[model samples]
Target: MNQGTPRLAVLATAVVIGAAGLAGCATGPVDRRALCTGFDKLGSELMSANGLFDNAVFASAGDLADLADRYQGGGLSADATALERISDADATNGFELERATSGTAKVCGHPLGLGTTSYAETGSGSTQANGGYGSYGGYGYSPPTESVTSTAPEPPTSSSPTTPAGDEVSARATLQQQVDTDRTQVETLADKWVPQLSSKNHGLVAHGTTYDYRAIWADFTATRQAYPSALLLWSGDYTSYTKGDFWVTVANQSFPTGAAANAWCVAEHLDADHCFAKLVSHTHGPRGSTLPR
Candidate 1:
């Protein structure tokens, strides 16, 4: 080989290193303004998880790390640091998780609810840290007191077994706030539990404005959001959905016995006609017959 060939190789290596350095420079810190949507979504989800008392929190440890990493990359040093602690905390330690969650709430001011360990809002704005279970806020909880009230406006009670006998205004607003807040989770549950239909299911459930989601969530709050639930997202567009289309249903599997499930419906002041035991198994379709109501 020529003596100049070694120098040529050195020059090539330097060029590659210089190009890599330039690429790194080009990919400098992300704009915080551009990160607003993502940051806000993470915050909003955290806040929702914090507010929910008895449901599975959707964010995972990896999700927490992802948000934290984004915060760090986008110049939110404190928030990034706080979330890092949560991501690194002992999974088995409830107190540590709670403390970390509370600490992160103070810094991030979203999922952990500032200065509060309680997931749900009580009259005194109190809730015990249920431990970091499935994800962020509420985790596995034993049978709680049945007197739990929620921020969601309750549907007006009457003798009607279908939708409640409320005016359009009330029906329009029934659990709307709560539904909006937990919309992501509600949809996630539906996608997991029910077969997605060809047409949208919301309009089919609209009782002049009261959608099935609101009616269903109202029932869930009665059980203090214990049982897993979702709306059967079947639209009238399908010919197969002859009966009980676009209905909301809690998981029958959550209850140990069919009697227990029926008893829950009876105890919750739910209409026996609208709220009854249903068996949804694998190989089911978006039809009433497929769901043994």
Candidate 2:
């Protein structure tokens, strides 16, 4: 036979003898031959039980029946109970291991090796050790820090020119004039379109004057065509009892005026009446009107 096999057999024999001696010390004198037989049987049962457990835990369907047979041949009844307990423990642990593995794989976007936590480092050098089992790059690795260069501030070049008070007043007047011109254009467009509506609806009341939706739409369209810098919000179907259909709405920031609101509707390409009825200004009132309950 192989030299290693003999050495292993000798070592096993020595272990069995030592175990029996310890048992004898605990109890009374034990028959060496009987104890040796028991040891042999116990060793075989332990090996078979362990193999069965490993197979079940790893989802490997091996010759479990054969292993079970060897386990049954063990000297004590407790051996069977011990085997069952081991199998139970392995099954429970295996289920937990599978769940933990799957969860970590999904969250970390990678598979974890055996006995590894979800936050375990991926080969990509990103550490996921800080978070829980499913957390990626938890406490194990540090984030990269970017180097910042500090520069001395440059001295002021020449003294900046200061505008006279009269010049500042002129600039303000010019800005107000532009504002007024834009407002007048918006009003004139409303006047042209106000008569087209079937209902004698008053124009949008802002800053004390009513502006027609069509006029606002014209001005909004013109502005968009010219600058194309207006903020566009989303438009979609809005169902309500009073309003038949909801259209697009736009705003200077979000939804500043009726014109901006109508602009949003037109951009979204929704029906005008539907968009107006569904506007935020119309939503505050009672179920049928613009007044809040």
Candidate 3:
């Protein structure tokens, strides 16, 4: 029994070694190029979402806040932040991507390619005379048991590595289209509202003091909702000269472009005395900040 135990132990050791060898062969290499490809796709999709948001107009402070919260809550932000850090740390443009790919490979229990982003193929070709052609080379012909055939070393074929630039270009193009559409809608709404100011008797007119800014804001919001791609450009006072009721005129409005604002004044048929484009940077603050009513 003791002699048998020794033989079994030896056999177990051999099995373990063989198993390890098999495992090693199974986990070939990590493909960093592929990882970069996936990362690029993810980043582009996230950017597209952001662009969509930027071009959209929210109905209220709540809607604006909700959109902001959604963007932050989405995993895209975290993934993009991580990718940005990786890109920053990747001095060689190849090292960090390589290391990240390697780390992923270890976890996945497989080896991937350890090289720059490139393609390669290894192949060889050979032409040999087997018996002869037609009937001579038919299955009936029994060739020599040992036949010498020389194989030619075929040239390696490779393709250029894919780049992330194309994704960025596409994203940019999509965003620009959104911007143009949004701008046009805002202008159209401006044209509609300018005439309504007097007929609807909605805002601070020729001699009115108290301005229903919120109502006007709501009107613009509704107009923007009609055009889904319009952005939340503004919802504030359009002041020309400010003071008390005696000399001050505060006609508050919201608009996407300076041209639209100026067009509002034109549509209202107001002389240069009352309203003008209140050109300044307008942004509804972060998700939780005070939103313009």
Best by lDDT: 1
**What shift in Å separates residue 255 of candidate 2 from its native position after superposition?**
14
Residue lDDT tens for model 3, 130-246: 111101001110111111121221221122222112232332233233333344434444422221111011223222211122222222222232233334322221121121111
Per-residue lDDT of candidate 1, residues 149-234 (tens digit):
22333233222233322243343344344344444443443322322111112233221222333233332332322232433222
Q: Check candidate 1 and list the clashing pairs.
A: 46-111, 47-111, 118-127
Model 3, position 189: C-alpha lDDT score: 40
Model 3 TM-score? 0.18
Report the lDDT tens digits of candidate 2 across residue range 1-293: 68899899999999999999986764333222332233333323332442233443332211221232243223323322333454445342221222222322222322222112223335542333311112222111111111112122121122223311223233223323333334433333321111011111113232222223222232233223322333221111122223221112222223434465445545544334323322222123324321111
RMSD of every candidate to native, in Å, equals 16.2, 29.4, 28.8
CA lDDT of 29 in candidate 2? 31
Ranking by TM-score: 1, 3, 2
**Candidate achieving higher lDDT, 1 or 3:** 1
lDDT of each: 0.35, 0.29, 0.29
